[model samples]
Target: MSLYGKGFMIWQLARCENGNGVEVARVARAAGLSHVLIKIADGPYTYNVDRTTRVDLVPPVVQELKKNRIQAWGWHYVYGSNPVGEAQIAAQRVNELGLDGYVIDAEVEYKQPGREQAAKAFMAELRKRIPNTPVALCSYRFPVLHPQLPWKAFLDYCDYNMPQVYWQAAHNPADQLRRCVNEFKNLAPYRPIMPTGPVYSAGGWVPTESEMVEFLDAVREHNLSSVNFFAWDYGRKGLIALWNKIAAYPHPIGPQPADIPEQYFSLLNANKPAAIANLYTDDAVHITASKTVQGKEAIQTWHKNFLTNSFPNATFEITSVSGTGSTRSFTWKGVSPSRGKIENGNDTIGLIDGKIAYHYKYFKIT
Candidate 1:
């Protein structure tokens, strides 16, 4: 059974530039996404216009999206201190654009003094006109709930509260999700929660598919109505992989793999390393390993090295595997000939020819 509704973050993607209904539809269909929240702009009051001359895209991508049966939402980039004059324009645009709902991305600092009143007024007026169309509010931390903050007032006006519970550079993601569920459960009972996770960042590190799966598992565990990614590019592969997986499951949510210490690690070892190397069916990946191996030769040599060095002599037990379908991870722990006894360490492995294709290890010296 489908999740009934699936959601994704749009804007700034190469696909967005294409602006063709067919391309958009193909991606949505492939990812099992039914709803797309198009990000119109970047930060505090910076609208993503086609050239600042035309704020909306030509021919309205929303119509194309809806044609493919994808519900579309308009995200207004706003800050606490921005002028109300622009707010009216934004409200008018939402109605004209025929968007299903509005996402108020609060990128400004609201805790500072003398900022709450303006923010409240803006949200109230916007809500007053678009009463039927749901409003999704975005905020960063618990600070958005401060007495000095207008989040409460905004919440009263909006339909749902979408807290950006992204743990990219903050605390560990697992810990962060658990804490967020507890906090939201107590504070926003009436509001349906849609937590946004970090799929990508400017830091250039893209999350693997399995890490994305873990995030989705968190969303399901918390019983959130839906989950959204931060931006278009970051860890986008993982986000799409997650959507495909959810589309397969009978229930959209599942149990978090907390009790199982090696649940993630074990999958790594079970992977067909040979097949992993040839994941990109269309293009060939240029791989260079530390042991002067490339392509198929590199993959086989690495696994062989591992078996010769660690297995039999030591307990070569797989610890966890974190990543999506083809692009997965393999973590193993035991005594090795290179060192003495080991606890938790990982060797990045890839597949080739239905077996292990590539394997390399990273080290963090203490």
Candidate 2:
């Protein structure tokens, strides 16, 4: 199915407009949304059946969304630890709810050892039960950052890729969305990416109205068919203005130079100091907080001695990137055994002929 249109994910039906299905539907319709993905199940046995409502809220919620001409899909948070049990419960809930579609919310738990086989088992079981329900895998936005997850295994059987592109601790939704879509497209068994942007605030950080609008704009500009928000409850309560802005944003469709910074981080995470050095010119200079290293050989030695060895398990996650063409700046967070935690690290790179000519790195360890 071609999943196109604006949508919101419903975490708890009971929390929506005081458990009034009609009110919830009215709110969704007012928001100009076309679909609602409701949380139906979590893990093997937990169903989001609100006891206070005294009704199997899924049916009523789905009915209301459908009544408002909004497609209603069910989402299940799969643990992947008990593949068979999780699949059985998810398939049973999907069948019982009679949802228009289903989404598997797989996360870090699925990144454990033997995850590929476990994901296959879950998918196989789910397919055996549903036979023909549209299923999608919803997980991390960056495929490169999560190499352990069984992305191909789950996506191979799924119909769509709904990545949770939550730009947490950052504000550049457009850039992040573009990178998210691009990275997923590079993977095998690629499916249509319908990203879920963050609406709820985390750690005192909430996306602004302008950022939400830019997110929709980026989605449309990328020729992506659909876009969805992370939530409805928090949005309706705290982000009404942002919510309305997104609803009114013109998302009519149509149509990467950041690879060097990306490759630097990737190589750094891989502990390939020599490979990272290769990205720079022979006389490239790397300026740190205390000292500077000039020449490729010196830079390689610095990375091997200070960058890699100092933190064996250190990984740099690019939070945001800015600037035009050759000169670019990026913000990142890193964690390692030696550093413990590094936050708000900034890097400026001057690229010549797609190779780093000069680089400056600054950060604080906490």
Candidate 3:
């Protein structure tokens, strides 16, 4: 029941105008979701966007979700009519009702000039009206929008970036999710990324429960903070079924395997450093050859020194490696990097990244 990183949003599927808005909130909460995104309904079947609606319907939904321990927010979708007005209205509603935040879904012209400035101005006006409300933006992926897109221009006025990464379901969704999160982080390393993942595709390919769990597992694997599903409803039966299946997953994917090579010899033969430093905390320490290295720098220096001294001209060949969370172990046979085939027995234990945390020379000469 610890809902820290999981989030769900209702876009057009459940409208406030309809009597089912309250029930929709119940369903979202029952499914172990911590966030409920209510897409403001301006279309038919929803009550008019007015102060009365805010007082009667909107705030009640927010409170209802809160009662079930779910953080509620308003996501205003903007298109041809210009989103600034709806953004203002939603922000006012959230502010009056004391909700968590607001999301501005902008469908912008990716090829237009001065579009960044226009987006910034819209965000600035929305912020001015909302004052203290946390603002977020939904935009296309970096590759689609160009690497030099005005992310900063919009991010400066907003709090988070929700890039829509609706890639096909492949072998490892987590790796893809990590890559996407990293790309956004590379754009603005300080800001958080809320990637939008699709549960079901338009072609009717619904990801299996294991696959959906794998997607979330991939998110956790990369230490990503949060995620958003592509949509609320589109008459897709598989999506609801998939959500139910994901809810049925015994546990949210816990700590995932570390992204490191299995053996030291493989890394060395591949021209890779025996140890990398940044993958650990600043104060991380390791015991190598019965000698405790205080920090990453010390560990790196020690690892390089030992390998060079023990096997002056040896090459490494990885045997096997596997681990989850922070603990990992690997074994390798050393050979001459230049020579085709000489073997040396020097086993190495790596931590986190490919850093040699502990090393022992099994045989002095082979």
Query: What root-mean-square deviation over C-alphas does model 1 reach?
Result: 18.8
What would the per-residue lDDT of candidate 2 be over residues 2-107, giving only the tens digit for each residue? 4567888888767778767788789888777777888888888756676676557777777787888778888889887889999998888887877888999999
Alpha-carbon TM-score of each model against the true structure: 0.59, 0.68, 0.60
Point out the worst 10-residue segment of candidate 1 by lDDT.
Answer: 255-264
What's the lDDT for residue 110 in model 2?
A: 90
Off by over 4 Å in 2: 51-54, 252-366
Q: Which candidate model has the greater TM-score, 1 or 3?
A: 3
Task: Report the C-alpha lDDT of model 3 over 84-118, residue by residue, as the tens digit.
Answer: 66556666666776768777665555235665666
| Model 2 Cα shift for residue 153 (angstroms) | 0.8
Q: What TM-score does model 1 achieve against the real structure?
A: 0.59
**Model 3 lDDT-worst window of ten:** 41-50
- CA lDDT of every candidate: 0.56, 0.83, 0.56
